[model samples]
Every structure is written in C-alpha cells, then in structure tokens.
Target: MNRRLFTAAGLALFATASLAAPALADSLDQIKASKTIRIAVDLGSPPFGMNDASMQPTGSDVESAKLLAADLGYKLDLVQVTSPNRVPFLLTGKTDLVMASFSISEERKKVIDFSEPYGVIQIIIAAPKSVTIKDLNDIVGKRVATTRGSTNDKEVTTQAPQADMVRYDDDATLITALISGQVNILASSPQTMAAINARRPQDPLEVKVVVKTNPYAIGIRKGDDALRAVVDEWVKTNLRNGKLNAIYTKYNGVGLPAEMLK
Candidate 1:
C-alpha cells in the first residue's frame, strides 16, 4: 500500500477506537465540585424505600442515602426510580449513586461496581399456609410473582424455572398482587411479606422457602474508583458507629447481622 494511504487508514482506525471507548466516570470529582450527589432510591419498595403517610420519602435506603450525603457535606438529591430502572439510571449518569436495596450479584458486577455490603435481604418464596410448598418441585406449576429486574426476581426465576413467573414493575404492585390473590406465590423479601400482611391481616403470607440471603450494597458506576472508595469508607465508618444499623433497624424492624457490623 502507498505510505499516504496506509497513514490515512491507521488514523481512521485510531479515531474509531477512541470514539468507541467509554469515558471514565468522574462522579466523585463532580460530586465534590458541585457539592451535591444525586442518588437513586426506589420509593415503591417499602421498608427499603417508600412514602410515609404525609407523602414524604421514608425508608432504610432513603435514610442511608441522606446520611451519606450529610456526612460528605454535600446536598442530597434523591432520585426516585423503580427496580428495573435503577441500574439504567446509574449507567446513564442520571444519578451519581444507587442506594435502592441493590444486591450484589455476579451478573450485576459485570456492568457496575458496588460498595461493601451495608445490609442483607433474604429472597424467599412466600405463600398462604394452605398452599403446599414442601420443596422446589412444589413450585413447578404455581404462579410466582416478583418485582421485575430485582435480585428476588432473578433468583426465583433461575431456581424455579418451571414455575409461571408473573413480574411486576415495582414492589408495591407485587405486594398488591399477592394481597389481591393475583398470584398464589411470591419471590420477595420478608419485609415485602410484612407489607402485604399489613394491608391484609385476614390472609397473611408465610415463608415457604428461603431462596438466598443476599447482601445489599450501594451501586456505583464502573470506572468510578474514587466514588467507590469514598462510599466504601463511608459504609465501613457508618457500620462501625451504629448509624447505619440504627437507620436500617428503624425501618426494617431488625438489626443488621452481627457479621456485617464487623
């Protein structure tokens, strides 16, 4: 090939490669400069995130995000999001972090980074006592409902592949479905079952099987090393000082696991 032609081709290839490469996220620097950090929290997910009687945002995850912002001396901008859109909001730069009961998983790790676990959530198959669920096989033909794109949904979908999966966009809707008998079984957290029972005491759901105990962490975008480190340190500090536990216990009605506090 002619030298001019070869040079032109190489330059074109380099430009394409550069354009395709993802820009590194500088959330930490941006947050510091702006003195504000936008965090995504799911208000539809009760106990973790929800609205109070006064229509104010109140929940474990909400308090956690607020505390983090307070500690960092930054203004808190709580971005409301649903389960399926949490990661998308973070990835798209709509939010600086996600404190939305986000569980750490191998699949999610491929797309985003996480801070050290601040709390844990149990994924469970809950049904009314009349429904027999002696083992995984018992779930084969049942209608199982869960919040779409959540860790609970992923675990149940993978474990009980034969079951008819009914996915809802958020926990509030999932809880309503269970209460209204739209589905006989659900893959969700114990907190969700509590929320269901709160509304319908006549027919309370019972835990049939515990799917998995998942550790939840704050979600940070990939390549945001500075933000991750800061968030991790904040988590460790809060976990040690009892602030995180207090916030979690206040809303969750249970203390954080002893091991997580350590």
Candidate 2:
C-alpha cells in the first residue's frame, strides 16, 4: 500500500477505537458536581434491601447508601436491582455504586472493584427440630428446598448431590416449602432463615450446618479507583464509629458480626 493510504487507514482505525472505548469519568467528581449519587439495591432482599409497608426502600444496604450520600453531601438516588442485574447496572452507569448485599468474590472482582467488607452473611442448612441433620451425609435421601439458581442451590447441589433437590422460584417459596412440610430441609441464608423463624416462632427451625461465610461489600465499576478509595475510607470510618453496626442492627435486629467489624 502507498505511504499516504497506510497513514490514512491508521488514523481511521485510531478514531474508531477511541469512539468504541467507554468514556471514563471520575465517579466522585461527577457525584459532587451533580449533587446526587445513584445506588443500586435489591429491594426484594429483606434485611439487606427491601421496601417497607409504605413502599419505600428501607433496609441495611439502603440505609448504608443513605449514610454514604449524606456524608458526601449528595442526594441519594436508589435504583432497584436484582442479583443478576446488579453488576450490569453499575457497568452501564445506571448506578454509581451497588450496595445490594453484594458478596465479594474472586470471579466478580475481575469485573468490578469492591470496597472493604461492611457486612457478613452465613449460608446454612436449616431444618425443623424434628429432623436431625448433622451434616451433608445426613442430608442424603432428604428432600431439600432451595431457591432456583441461587447460591444456596448451587452449594446444596454440589455438597449433597445425593439429596432430593426441590427448587422454587424464589426464597419465600423455598422457605414455605420447608415450613409447610413439603420439604424436609432448606438451604438458605441466616438472615432469610431468621425471617422464617419470625413468621413461625412456635415451630422454631434450627441450623444444621453452615455452608459458607460471605463478606458483603459495595461494588464499583472497574478502574474507578478514586471512588473506590473514598468508599473504602468511608466504610472504615463507619466501622470504627459503630455507625455501620447501628444501621445493620436497625434492619436485622442485631449488630454487625464481630468478624465483619474487624
């Protein structure tokens, strides 16, 4: 090819590449300039993020976001997100950060940055007192219920492959199946089991075994280090001041876990 033609082609390619690249904006600066910060939360997840009787979002994650916005002197704009959509929402700039009980994991870290963990969750196997389930072996041959496509479902399927798995559309349905005697065991989170216990105080479910301990943190888009640093500092300060614990207690009826405080 002629030198002139080669040069023109190179310039065209460079322009196309630049146009395809996402415009990187300083998240903190944008929030400050706009006087607002958008946060994604799963309003369907209770104690962590859920709507109150008045249909207003009010939960541990929601309250934490509110505190963060207050500290930054910006208005909080909440966007409802589900487990599958949380990361996409943040990446697409629909939200500045995600505080919807997002559990930090190596796989997710590759796509997004996480602030220091501010909360912890225990995935457990819960069953009625009548059912004696000491471990995964005991779960064998038992009818286990879990939310379809959830972390609990994946764990149960892996750990107790011998067990009869009954998947429900959602957590509420899975819990119901267990409580109503349709299923003998349930794989669920501690907070979710606590809700079930509250509803059926007389029945009294017990935890058979803990499957995993997950640390929850705020999720930011990758390369947004400035915003991530600010969030991390804010979380550290709140953890030390007990403000984070207070927010957790307000929703879960208990203070933050001692391990999480560290």
Candidate 3:
C-alpha cells in the first residue's frame, strides 16, 4: 500500500482506535511506581527529534524529554512515534506522554490534555525562491507536501483546499520529497525549512507565507490530572531556568518566543 494512502486511512481510524483500546496505568503515581516515564517523540522530525551522527537520539524534543525525566527522578523511556501516532499511543497506553512537536489545538484537546506551552513553531508555506507565491492563490494546483497528521497539514489543508496536497508519513520523508523534487512547495516549520536549505543550499527554499504560529506542548491522556499538573509544572520550571530555551535555541538556531519564556 502507498504510504500516503496508508497514513490517511490510519488517521481516519484514530477516534475509533482510541475509544476501543483498553486502558493501562498512565497516572503520575504509576509512572513513579514503574520508575520510568515513557515519552513519545518523533525521531524523524529534525531539530525537534532526530538521530545524531552516531545514530543516537538527539534533538530538541529528545533533550527536553531527558530533562523532564531527570528532574522528575524517573528513567527515561523514549517511545518512537510519528506525527499521526502520538495521540493514539498515549490514548492506548503505549506511551505515558507525547513530546513530538505536538501542537495544541481545540480539535486535539477534545481527546487529550496538553501541558502549558513550552515552545512555539511557525508553520509556513515554503518554496523555491523563484516561485512567485504572494498569496494562497499562488499555491493552487501546485503540489504542496507536508507531514501527514501534523498541524502544518491541518493548516494548509484548511486554508488551501485547491492546492495539490501530498502527504508523507513523517517530516523526514516530507523533507526528502522537497529535496528530491517530488514537490516544489511544502507546508512546514522554520526549523524544518532550515534543515531543507542546509541540504540543498544551492537551490534553497524560502518561506512564501506564514501559515500560523502555534504553541507546541506535551500531550497527556485525558483524565490524567496528576500527570498533567506535574508535566505543566515541569515545563514552567524548565522555562524559567532557561533549560528549555537553551535546548530550543541549540537546535533551532533561535530562542523561543518571549511570552513563552514567561
């Protein structure tokens, strides 16, 4: 089966899967009892979560998860997940928390809880510099690639319904699509754009329009109030101590929004 088609089908079953799955121990107490916190991070997303030179997990989200586990005095168990599976993993007891650049949205809040915003990501429409895209109309009929089941996908699909939408299973694949000429335009983040440009510096892509500036947060299962509170407080403490900001800047090449720091 085609990966894109498979992703679309899987996304459609999210609600059904969440409702049918059996529950597990996902409380703060349970996490403490187990002495491990399973955090779902997308290893395919660069600057946020990706393998380093030695094939070890190393990225903003990866480091953030480590910091969280260390501070909370638990063993860090990183659960590898993609954009679409983050919420499902949490709901089905496969993971305790999701820190995979998961954006907070009203639609998502219906199924899961979110911690206070720890960082911000700008979703933008980027294309080759030569492409004239001053507005949404310019994207019409053009192939626009994005990671399936991401905030970028939602924003672009909602705003540019006429564009030719090409979805990939993960950001790594989406980046590959852009770099390999599978698509000239993409809906992604500034950090992702930087990654793309780094690989194809000679014909680098530039942001044509800012889709939205979204605040990404850790995702906790619904009704996990104790875990939510602990995660939220951990975010606050890390933001105040500059630990989170330092991690974001190290990979993204920019500091987080000033408001988020507060």
For this target, which candidate reaches the highest lDDT against the unseen true structure?
3
- In the range 1-262, model 2's lDDT, one tens digit per residue, is 1011111232222222111124558788898899999999999888888888999989899999999999988999999998866766676678899999898876667557899999887778988898888888998887888889888888889988998988999877876776677776778877777777887787867888988878899999877889999999999999989999999887876567786677
- RMSD (CA, Å), candidate 1 to true, equals 8.4
Number of the top-ranking candidate, with TM-score as the measure? 2
Give the Å shift of residue 53 in candidate 1: 3.2
Q: Model 1: residues >4 Å from true position, as ranges?
A: 1-25, 125-187, 199-209
Q: lDDT value for candidate 1?
A: 0.83
lDDT of 2 at 197: 80
Error of model 1, residue 17, in angstroms: 19
lDDT of 1 by residue, 2-79 (tens): 011011232221222111123544888899889999999999887899999999999999999999999999999999
**Candidate with more favorable, higher TM-score: 1 or 2:** 2
User: What's the lDDT for residue 102 in model 2?
Assistant: 91
Cα lDDT tens digits, model 3, 1-262, are 1011112233442534224346555478888889999999999888899998999999999999999999999999999999877776777788999999888877677677899999889988999989999988889998899999887898889998999989999888988888888888989888888888889888999889988888999998877888999888999999998999999999997688788877
Reference-based TM-score of each model:
0.69, 0.82, 0.72
Error of 1 at 73 (Å): 1.4
Off by over 4 Å in 3: 1-18, 21-26, 125-187, 200-209
